[model samples]
Target: MDVLIVDDEPLARERLTRMVDQLDGYRVVGQAGDTASALGAISAQDPDVVLLDVRMPGEDGLSAAHQIGELDDPPAVIFCTAFDQYALDAFGTDAVGYLLKPVRAEQLLEVLEKARRPNKLQRQAKQTEASQSSHNGRSHISARTPRGVELIPLEEVRYFIADQKYVTVHHLKGEHLLDETLKELEEEFGNRFLRTHRSALVSVQHIQAMERNGDGHYQVRLADTEQRPPVSRRHAGALKDLLQKL
Candidate 1:
């Protein structure tokens, strides 16, 4: 299994990497000191599991994991914290495993053996918990890229369309398919995003026009883009009101 070690302390990362290297069927692919770097490493390396630290300078491991949960094929997160109390909350986050620091080799091996990829439901639960406990919603959306994870500010977003099991975020630059659901996003962003379709939520700020197609289907056009997601009957009236207010 590929592993990424995320800790603010160099000593902690070195220790975890050494222990993981000693184990068979596992390799330490990368290491990061902060949440952003850890996220970039996870996106770039596609590690099977991450040994994440709870406390850090910027975003903590738990909060970062919540954002990571939105990415497609997110790695299994195993939080490594000095706080025993935080470790006890692992089950609520749906983490496969966690280790209390200073981690022993045997404990590391045990957790590795038990680690598994989290499903959509598990990721959602983690994000939900993070949102409920936090004062504000997420400022940026994380998207996986070959080089690393790209942070897209919510301001640049045009719309969110739920395609099958995934929701695509249409932003200023481009679009990214995320593991998040439209409902989750709606709850997260609140009044910022208006439901335009059962499978779509559009940014009120990005609303350019509402035009009817040849089939008499009204599509909500966005700013700085040609893409127009169809509006469903249920949400069309509300969308119209939102546009009028905007």
Candidate 2:
């Protein structure tokens, strides 16, 4: 199998490359540090299997797999990560395999032996799901920053407001600009977030009250924060009805 090794760390990539090199049945075709480069490698090398890291600087592995799922001919994926907590989410992407960090050569070799590409029909079905945004929603939001990747639990996020191309993730710790759009966020976090405006998705847990400002516009107040994102007339009625049910 032609294998593509993707990880943010140079050492991790080199180590996996070396392991795959020693294996008789597989060949390392390319290496990548993040999702963008990985996609490019996938296009250029057309590897049969990808060893993807779960967490990275900007786009995490799961999201990358979700994107990869859209391809007409997608490769089998084997996720690599330090945290075992993401195992379930990793599998949800229909990955053929999953490996923990400090991967054992024997384990990797076994996974390779088992990796099978989905048939054309199966690939089409997965692509359809991705187009419809029906894949399993992520449990935690992957936030990218200058320091490193920060995994924010869904519970900590108060709201997500669209700002031009990016969505602002307002959490208990503060706010971070997420690359995801408001629509995608709403689709992934349905039931957990209530749409107050076209640009805002407020967490149900954080919404404390519905208020009317002096200007007569309605607003949704979030817990532990003074900033209230305006409620649009289109969704105001639905928001009010849902809030009253609680």
Candidate 3:
């Protein structure tokens, strides 16, 4: 398998390269420091798997992945980030895997295998399907501020937190208090978002880890951010099952 290591740090790239070297069936075709070099290599070498860094000097991995998707045969993307939030959006692009920093060799090889034999067409089809589902009735979601029925891009939303009668939409930019309740939003967007707590709906991508507290209560840790949302006891089991899959 042809692999491209895209990261800002030379040591990180070298570490991954060493792991790939030890593996029998894989070869490191190229190494890039930043987004420009990464994209150029993709255009030139057309690697089979791009081990992309979540944070970079110029263009971030997520932005580069969007551009790469425009290619006729884009390589499989496996994100390598020190942070966590990018995983959610990363998977939205048919990403086969997401690895945290100082990646385990076993995990890398496992993801590489999955990337090697995946139904790319089916994954793309699912994205198209999800997008189509988002479009049909999203416009009807009333906004609180005169932001007035803002067309919330389905993928951009980090999560929705219910507060009494209103649910606030949390995203990278900031927060918006939408008029709809958690129940209403969940019914409309349940397929894409997962219910993490009685009062919170987490973007599955933002979830990096779910830990059990001293009292056996569970809490969710968000990627790239420090805030941890406590999981309702009722939803703890379900959230644990979901975390296992991620």
Candidate whose TM-score is highest: 1
Please give, for residues 1-246, the per-residue lDDT of candidate 3 as tens digits.
678999999999999999999998889989999888987887556577899998998788888888877654467888999888877888887577899887998998888888877433344335436755774546333455665556566566777887545678876656788767676676566656666665678777778888877878677877655556667543465567667887
Clashes of each: 0, 0, 3
TM-score, every prediction: 0.49, 0.48, 0.48
Give me the displacement of residue 59 in model 2, in angstroms: 0.6
| Candidate lDDT values, in order | 0.78, 0.81, 0.74
Per-residue lDDT for 10-46 in model 2, tens only?
A: 9999999999999996889899999999988876666
Expressed as tens digits, the lDDT of each residue in 5-110 for candidate 1 is 9999999999999999999988998999999999788655657788989999988888888876776546788999998888666656757888899899999998
Q: After superposition, how far is residue 62 of candidate 3 from its true place, in Å?
A: 0.3
User: What's the residue-level lDDT of 52 in candidate 3?
Assistant: 90
* Residue pairs with clashing backbones, model 2: none
Give the C-alpha lDDT of model 1: 0.78
Candidate 3, TM-score vs. the true structure? 0.48
Clashing pairs in 3: 84-223, 84-224, 88-205
Ordered by TM-score, highest first, the candidates read 1, 2, 3
